[model samples]
Target chain A: MGWFSWGNKNQDISEPSRQNRQKCWETRDSYFDCLDRANIIKPGDEGNSCAKEKQLYEDNCAKSWITYFNQRRVLADAQKDRLAQAQAQADSARK
Target chain B: MREVSHFVTLMFSQRALASLARRTYVGGQQTARHGRRNFSQTLKRQSQFGKDRNTIGTLTPASAAVFVATGVGLYFYFRYEKQKLLEEREKERSSRQYGRPQIGGPFSLTRSTGETFTEKDLLGKWSLVYFGFTNCPDICPAELDKVGTILNKLEPALGKTFLPVFISVDPARDTPERVGRYLADFHPAFVGLVGTYEAIKGACKAYRVYFSTPPNADPQGDYLVDHSIFVYLMDPEGQFVEAFGQNTEADQIAARITEEVARYGK
Candidate 1:
């Protein structure tokens, strides 16, 4: 059921936002890696010691990525619609 | 013997005895034998009566209480076992080929009226949910139409126990107002939902829906969104009951749902 991911790609994002998002994702990844090394399947909540890096990533980069991802999706949708209309117009002219 | 003779003479006169003698006369030995037989019979009858009393007297109150309690307990225990077996058989009879999948969970989206719609809103009624964008070229429109027809047929049989819901997969273009306009062309009772990309994605994931990037789209936004097309039926408890594929006809869906609702209440 995981056919597509919401966090797949945001190529059109600004350089700084992209860097920030990457850094946050990396930080979260590193925390998960640490958990893996420690043989922990799931990290503890805010009160637990293992959540510090993950919390940092959530606070710094996750919000920006969410916004960028949504913007990209909307723009892509608009582009698709424009293409369909152009094709429709061409077909009508030929007819 | 002399005393007995005197009593008998007093009771019956000589003339009467003489007349009785003409009918039949009991000799002394015969009379004694008859008396002994009567005495032995009376003693045996008394002993049998006494034995019956002794048996009844042995049944104390504690033992009587135990006897009554055991009788009642066994009766209810057997009844419970019979009911349990019946329920198991019913479950086996109703077992489905599409085993229960963990589909559906909490989701928050905006209704057509600019109100927040959550999973709680789906409670207390049966719901038929389909995921697609309003701008879908053919499949979405066709499926929605079929759903509308099914709803119309279902209404006569099920009344208002069923709800039809359309959740947008392409939330970017399907605003609440746009969704509302799209649904207006279908069933009047249909509810349209639109939300942020994350919210819509979460809802789709929960329902095991598949959708990917639009195919063959130009720079302009006119392409069709590709997504899985199925109408999901939910029970009153917001659990998944079944899903109907694209080829299923409206009447087929209606009949199946009518049977389902009759067998298991909304």
Candidate 2:
């Protein structure tokens, strides 16, 4: 009964604390850095390269956060490409 | 010299009367030759009586100038009045648009303290309502922090008359207790609300908030719910006054709310 109560308490306190969130962000950054070193624009593409870092990130952060971060990483890269293309077009137009 | 000026004025008056008679006679469609003979008789009579053709010539030009000036003045006067009327109408239309925004309506949800809260609860106080989930990693926290800053800035002067509310879009994962605990990290004055999926959907619809948390999604599953991030300002009467986007500065929002509160008092 005590074990069940403890589990209930854990379920009730679902949101991460401030320190836990910081830890999650740290792990996420480390994992993303590994992915960047591997030249992988997409997160899931680096299968075995950053497995340890990915495990740490998954354990620290919530599932929803992980999904959001992965999607945002890809989106940010795409946005960079678009901005570069726009800059090149602007330069050519100026000439 | 005065006698001579008076005589010239009398002569001009006589000439005006003669022209009036000629116009009336022409209106009757009399013979063209008869009209010409009458004009010649008047001219002969004028020449015999005064022999001052120079006075008549000069007076004609002066009267013509006065007539043209009066016509132009009337034209501009009417145009100015028309322009003023159009501007007044535009002002009234804009006031009507801003005075009564159709943003909020009937909604029911559970407050963080396990009490029933409805749109009626929003009445009698200015409320800042935001729609977000506790699981939002970065944006929601940043926005809530901004709201906290605004509340802290306004609380001293506006105290109790102002309320900040957070409504959870992710009902499946965010229970009232969880939402309450999450909001404790921000301003204590905040009223966190959560409800069943249908109730949350109705509330979102009432506020015109677009959230993408699917019904029947696994509560334990890891997925992000995309939603609109706008903080709505409602007047004491529960009518929406404005919606502040994510980029709006806390100072700007505070200034706006202070202005609105003053205006409402009036």
Question: lDDT tens string, model 1, B43-131?
Answer: 34534555433333224477557656755666676678889999998787667524687888889999987999988899988899999
Cα-based lDDT for every prediction: 0.67, 0.82
In candidate 1 the C-alpha lDDT for residue B25 amounts to 18
DockQ of each: 0.01, 0.28
Error of 1 at B104 (Å): 1.1
- lDDT tens digits, residues B70-96, model 2? 556656766788889999999997897
Please give each candidate's TM-score.
Answer: 0.48, 0.68
Write out the backbone clash pairs for model 2. none
> Which runs of model 2 end up more than 4 angstroms from their true locations?
A1-13, A34-40, A44-52, B1-100
Error of 2 at B215 (Å): 2.5
Model 1 lDDT, residue A33, Cα: 65
